[model samples]
Target: MNKIVAIMAGSVWKVLVQPGDLVEEGRDVIILESMKMEIPITADFSGTVKEVKVNEGDFVNEEELLIEME
Candidate 1:
């Protein structure tokens, strides 16, 4: 399994992947709102999404796990 984690502390603005979705390396998988700016978080590895750990509008700390891939 691979993890997609929040790059910074923020509220999750959008979730671009769900379980069973395909993802590519560097593809934006989540967008976070911090300091009123939209920060896109990208996939670190190309794989099928295994789980979505956070929901839209959920606040996350830096490095919190967002998605799992396999």
Candidate 2:
């Protein structure tokens, strides 16, 4: 199984992937905004995106699970 981890502490600005989307390692799956800057959440492994755990504009902490893969 693969997991996508949040890159920073921020509000989720957008979700770039949906369930069943094929994601490559180091791909940006979500965008977050913090301190007026945008950060991209990236996948650590290549796999099909199994789930998106957060919605647009949702607040997320550092290291949160943004997506699951398998």
Candidate 3:
């Protein structure tokens, strides 16, 4: 399993991929808004998305798991 994690503490602005979606390394999987700036969270490994761990508007902390792929 591959885990995609948040880089900063912020509110989840958008989820770009869904379950069963094919993802490549470095592809943006989620967008986070913090201090009025948009931060894109990308996949660290290429795989098919297995689960989305958070929803839009949810607050997340640094190092939090955002997506799970396999």
Top candidate, metric lDDT:
3
Give all candidates' CA lDDT scores.
0.93, 0.87, 0.94
lDDT (tens digit, per residue) of candidate 1 on 1-70: 7888888999999999889998989899999999999999998789999999999999999989999899
What is the per-residue lDDT of model 2 for residues 1-70, given as tens digits with 9 covering 90 to 100? Answer: 6677777789999899999998888888899999999987777778998989999999988878888899
The Cα RMSD in angstroms, rounded to one decimal, for candidate 1 relative to the true structure is 0.6
lDDT of 3: 0.94
Clash count, predicted structure 1? 0
Clashing pairs in 2: none
Candidate 3 has what TM-score?
0.96
Sort the predicted structures by lDDT, highest score first.
3, 1, 2
**lDDT tens readout by residue for model 3, 5-62:** 8999999999999999999888899999999999999887899999999999999999
Model 2 bad stretches (over 4 Å): none
Each prediction's TM-score against the native? Answer: 0.97, 0.91, 0.96
